[model samples]
Target: MTTSVSIFPIRHHGPGSARSLEHALSQLNPDVVLVEGPSDADPVLPFLTQRGMKPPVALLGYVNDDPARAAFWPFAAFSPEFVAFRWAARASARFMDLPASATLAGERRNDDHDDLHSDPLRVLAEAAGHADFERWWETLVEARGDDFEVFDAINEAMRAVRADAPPPTGREAQREAHMRQTIRAALKDGAVRVAVVCGAWHAPMLDVDAFKAKDDAALLKGLPKVKVTLTWVPWTHGRLSVGSGYGAGVRSPGYYDHLFTTRSAVTERWFARVARLLRAERLEASSASVIEATRLANTLAALRGRALPGLDELNEAALSVFGWDSDLPLRLIERELVVGEALGEVPADVPTVPLAQDLAKLQKFLRLKVQPEQIDLTLDVRTDNDLARSVLFHRLNLLGVPWAKERYAGGRGTFKEAWALAWKPEFSVQLVEASRSGQTVHDAATATATDAARTAGTLAELTTLLESVRYADLSGATPVALAALDARAAGSADVSDLLEALPPLARLARYGDVRGRGSESNTLAGGTFRTLLTRAGVGLPLAGVGLADDAAATLRGKVNGADAAVRLLDDPDALRGWQAALTRLADRDDAHPLLNGDAVRRLRDASVLDGPEVERRLGLALSSSVPLEVTAWLDGFLDDSGAFLIHDAGLLALLDDWMTGLDATVFQETLPLLRRVFSRFGKPERRAIGETLRGGGAAGRGVRRELDEDRAMLAVPVVLRLLGVTT
Candidate 1:
């Protein structure tokens, strides 16, 4: 091979390297520029320079059939490759590297070949007496003029450091051989000057002829093949940060963009942006603050011996001049100014899988743009568009794309859904992978749900998946989910599971029909509800027997759920059967006292039992039971309110007598459970109970005097009128 090729090795996102390369390319005027990237991406080079195309987008390559085997070559506005691509597009260039299908296949089996090359930047940083390579490199290289010799020096240093390193392994050897072959082919094509831009580490190896062409060809021969596709997709600044889980990601993409765009007056421009951001946040950041912050940044640069202020200095200046004692203001600067929130754009005509196109249509229709910034959305489900957005968010979440998270916020109203949405670069990858299930988001989510339903082993899991599917409106998978539900429910003997599963189905049967569940789904859900409720009614009483505190507590929830389900179902026979089961549990002596008391309270709330029956049950529980049993009974009875004690003086007196009879030890033992039960009481009810203990009848009204018959009769019509119930 000829020695006519000059390789400019660069740190991936270094602004200084970009400037140097640009200058070097202008002076050399090479006929062809070869860059390090997947050779399969050669055809897309022209698209990279098309008008309106932006950086921070990536060249994505994956197996067409198996998307899990994939790789990304991301480019930020400051990336040297991005600059090279722009220059090459003006002067026509080609990509020279192994194809992605080969790289991915090699990666599958190359895990055993450990790369021994240490980070070259760290070695140089140590030699420069700096703890961080970025800071040192910025001070020495980036802040200086664009001299192409800096690349030569960097190449020499990296070569010297790796001189004692282990020889390249089999896969790496084959890759280097292929690169050499590519360079040989380019030179033989009569190109007078060739410029190659590659990662700094690979430069030293490329210049050396370590393997012969014939041996390299044999090593690369008979390589495994896989179908692969290439496309361009958007990326984000948050994901461009190293902490966002990309190995080659930068610490501050915004800072690099600033350096790349405005190579001079760096501190002045940065502080002005910070001032604007602070003012937008309603914090005080005037022009005076901007001037002071700029001064402080320059001072910090001087103290740190940096040629110019970097991100660290600028952030420190913002924290100091903003008069914030904490880093809270600095964190805002980091998010808004240091890292940025920009999302890259791909052309509308760009080719993508059908699923991606469908998703884009849905997002556009919903006016939801995938961005790097976290946005809070309050959706009223009564609004059609809002409901559609909610459904899309839920489907994405279930498919393992967490672009949106449901947030529990207060006071937004019952029909309002709160969500926090922030799109990451990996979400595109997830979306692409999810396409294997179906061609649309709904279809994919439904297929995934169906698979989960088929594999579920428990009634609880199936019921949960069913609820999710119903909420997400995945109608196509309804049959699969319904079949799984029926199978699991028919086999499940747990009364609690049956009871817990009935409410959602009952709600669907009652109200879901009006919410567009279709007549078929409503009918299926109604049938499932009836079958499970029937099974639950037969087994509930037995389930109550011999329940420990935890199990009994769990069953009490189930009982409450059963109460709501029967009411929602409103089927005369089902209600009567469920009440009968509750009556049996209440009357059985072997049932847990908690269950018994729950049954009695439910019966009272349903108005099936009169005051006298509640009074009789209270008297029996108070007089005969031990202190713990009595307290447990009180726990279930008192569950969440003291309103029951207000209307019934006889029951209140019964409680008073029971407490007075308990000795000091029993009182102490009962206090905790009593506190737990009383804690559930709201403020108004607790205050009324306290007043009752002080001899004030409900709400400090003294003992109810005999109502004057004439006055009370006259007040009846007034009371009815005030209650909006005309006589």
Candidate 2:
């Protein structure tokens, strides 16, 4: 009636350890197999063996009340724990760690400062004359054949290392105590032979006879607990790397995967894959290059006195054989083959919230692949499928799951939208939290948007939410948001806020046409746009008056935004009203010169003012204003481009004549501001303006240019033929 326990310690994500563990498990065939994972995740263990279950997945455990307090036990196909789970599915298996309830409760002590206990592998690796523990382990255990004898060597080595190491304390102490207790319970349950799989650092401490059960119970007592929920979520290979901040992560999960999956000719297969990837990118990688790379890798490994070529040797060979001058191609190889960007999948029948289920169904229907790597998606809203994709992205963003962030699609018009998408694992918790609003993603997002709109403190927030609602096509939320927006607009007196709110409203109105929403949406958004524009126009003159330099610049930006919004709407009445407001601002001598000059420029650009009127305004501003005020006036008039100066001969001559009349002191003072204004122009336009000035000013240059009547007349017959006139 004696119970025997065999402890198999492993590096968390090591492919070599995984392969060895699998082979060892097949030989031992213990009565019960236990792995290091959240014990609360035991219920979902069955799902691991399901056909649709893929690795690069994690067991997600979170506090039921606050999903933000969560933990992940990630498992890749090459992880020892993943292999153990698969092995344990046929036999009896269980998770043998502290339940996630206590772990997520955040009650662990921090008094333990023992370096050896914290990272025993580092101490052992240092003793072995290696600086990096990962490389040392890979050279010794991973690169070797799958022999159970390596476990004995690992166990013995850990025993020697722990002989001088400090006793585990705080959370580490509690975890080992719990692991020992779990082993005792398994033995007491009539299991003759038990298999305990855990981290190499904790392997030497799991003997049931080495620690007292009473002491273990006392260490476990009074641990705080909370209501916990567990489920499976997809993970990614990039997230499994040490660079991603995963404490138990490997340096190269993809390389480890190649090690575990490729049993024979590992270096050959890897080099072949690298060659194919290079060729796919149109880089020069030939069959001869692949063979040479493989030979160089094996040769280097032999020179280093190693059993097989590791990632370092393989990479070196690839770099040397590929004749790459930069590490850029090597980095590409690393990303594609070393770290990888593979995303895992969970089975459809897995337990999850209704909103998540609905999203999955939608993703499948739309043929959208949920990936870990960021991908650029351009949606043509005119197509039914792309339109649905856009709606889904907007709705998800509303629910605070920014799975796809909106990006500028460039000038493709309203028919196209761009998004940068990269799905995160924490989005699962977001989905669960959002489920309280509704059972489906669309409904939940609509409810969330409606609530936000109702509680929005300002008209700008309301209009912004309204724009998102329109994009999402949230019919249930649109009316509520619009009503909220109108109420805020009526009470709002800040003309700047009114102006700020106009652009989104105008866009919403214009987008209604693209979405084919009929007159109802257009009327709602267009009416709101008109009301805000009218209020903004009435208060703009007062807003511009008596403003300081900074305040004037801020107000000018709002004015520019409003003008652009009006043009975007393309409504004649809106443009006329906006132009009238600009005219009043321009005529008010008390207004900031920046605002006055910008107003005049807007009128000129709108063709409401003729060339003579603009010339008169420029002359008056330059003569009546001080040096600083004149600089501000010029900046506002020129805006950000010198194209106006390049094309308008009279305006350029007027500016040149004014500069020549300035006193030396005034010219010195205004030099910086003039530089600031002209620096905003593009190089080509600035060069053109300089040439016009250098050729004896715009007016003189025009008079100096000589045209030949014969050369001009030579093109008349060709022009007549092009116009289809029989001359």
Candidate 3:
């Protein structure tokens, strides 16, 4: 009943390895071929060879119940397994690795071994006089030969390296044992010959007696099992680099793909492709350049005693022939030709996780096809359709799937949001893991937001999270976040923290109505704002005294936040209370002059002071007695706007009188603030202010409106009552 099984090991992405295996399969014509992958993926093997199916795809194996514990076996056009799969489909081969359930369960059992000190590839690369293993592998193994004999040398090398390395443990040990069992089963099936294609590292261990069949059985016995699914998903050439997190990533998959598919004149064919890529970029890469580069590449290869030119030789030739003294243009060749931007496609019938499948359906329904390239998605969240897209992106972000990132649009565009979206192949893994939270994106986002709110340490972080929840339309999470916000606000005493927390809360209160959700949230926000503003009012003046410029900048942000809160609250009582506090701070001489100026400007903007009253106060503050306050006030109040300078003649005269009286030293000392304030003025405004200062205006117009003390005193009772300061 026993069958003859021929064990052949391969490097995962090596084109030479793929060619050698193809030759071996044709020569031996084995009855069956067995590959190393999740056994569950075997069912979907037919889907891979279906028309329009492409390389640069992966077998996504995960436990259906717990998608977070997953593994990827990616294959490019040049991957040995991909070639083997094609050969096997004709020969009706099967997957011979551990099932996803067992692999994931083994991982959960703490059965993992990772040796930090030793690497077999580094040892071989160093021995080959190459700094990088990929270069060494390509030059020594892939570029020279494409026959079964090459694998024999590779096997012996790996055996020697394995002797010096630590043995596999836990999940790795289980995986190897399961592989052995599958090989045994294949052999017992009575085939004339069986080609067992696996990673070269595992070749020596495949001898049947090394792990007794019963021991293999014992290793897999009683392991916790879960339902698992396998699916084929598209992959990218750029992702072929190790940076994409594939375990056996190729440095240049597109190049290897060329090697795998080309029959003769491989170097010539590669150069032609490079020429095409350069021409596409509007670079000068002609047929003549290709011929010269090919000759140069071959010459370099011959000088180095290589059978064929590798990427390094070809790249060197590209630099010399393309007229590029630097590597900048050469880098373009590397990305477009070497790594490439091509994406693979899979048959639609392949089984996928429910969440992944649902997301695909939703993406289609929403008309947002997943793209391999990055794109900007601008959304007017005020519109229903755009709002849906924005909400989907935010929801995915909530579940730790960052397919899109919110970008600042720079304005008070409360309804406008810009997102940079690039859907990666690996986002499927995140979606699988997130599926545990809930069935739909909306449900999962709500669950994730609630969890974040529950664990959030600060009121600001909680408030920001709540804003994300609202933006994602996870209304279910709002109640949980609001409750957490209340608890956090009660215990927090830092005024800056309260300031940071208020704007998002206030925005939600004001705008939530348009979205049909914020009335209750608004009430909660109003209450939190009242409590925070009351505490901030008592501490604001004290905190601002003697602040450095850096601290003043930080305080300026907090002040702006308070300003936003005032606008959003739209409550007369809260406005009056906050305005009163700002007035008190503005009157204090010891307050940070920046804060004083900001308070005065805020009060002016709020229409709390008449034009003449503001001018009189500026005259008092700009006098020589308060030089430091003048600079601080100028930086804070005059920094952002110059409108008042053009229209308010009283303020202009007060500024003009103060400047005329300043001595040379005082002028020099305040010049920075003077330039800063003037810089904000438009050219026209600056010219007008300049002409007025140079005596262009009518002389002695002394635009002071004399205050009638008796008239002002007549309204004292009304002012005192408004101030809650009755005598």
Each model's backbone clash number: 0, 0, 0
Q: Model 3: per-residue lDDT, tens digit, 1-727?
A: 4567677877778776677788878888888888888876777889877887887898887776667777777888888788887877677788878787666665544331332122344456667686444446556555556555666777787778678878877667777888898888876777668788988777877777777899889987886777877788888887887656544666777777777788999889988888887788787888988999999999998898777787889888888988566676688877777877677888766766566777777788888867776788777877888878887888889999998888886533367778898878888888888888888887888888999999998778988897788778777999999899888887888877877887777766666634565577767766777777787777777777887878978988887888777777787877888888888888888877788888888888889987878877787678637676787786776756676776666777777767766888988887776887688778887777666555564422544445669878999899899999958
Per-residue lDDT, model 3, residue 289, is 87
lDDT of 2 by residue, 481-520 (tens): 9788878988999999999898888877776636676458
Estimate TM-scores for all models: 0.80, 0.89, 0.73
Better of 1 and 2 by TM-score: 2
Identify the superior model by lDDT, candidate 1 or candidate 2.
Answer: 2
Relative to the true structure, candidate 2 has a C-alpha RMSD (angstroms) of 8.7
For candidate 3, the TM-score is 0.73
Model 3, residue 431: distance off in Å is: 1.5
Deviation in angstroms for 692 in model 2?
1.4
Error of 3 at 465 (Å): 5.1
Most lDDT-accurate candidate = 2
Per-residue lDDT of candidate 1, residues 507-577 (tens digit): 67776623455678777888888788888888888888998989999989878977887887789988888
User: Residue 643, candidate 1: how far off, in angstroms?
Assistant: 7.6
How many residue-pair clashes does candidate 3 contain? Answer: 0
Best by TM-score: 2
Pairs with steric clashes in candidate 3 = none
Error of 3 at 424 (Å): 2.3
Candidate 2 residue-pair clash tally: 0
Better of 1 and 3 by TM-score: 1
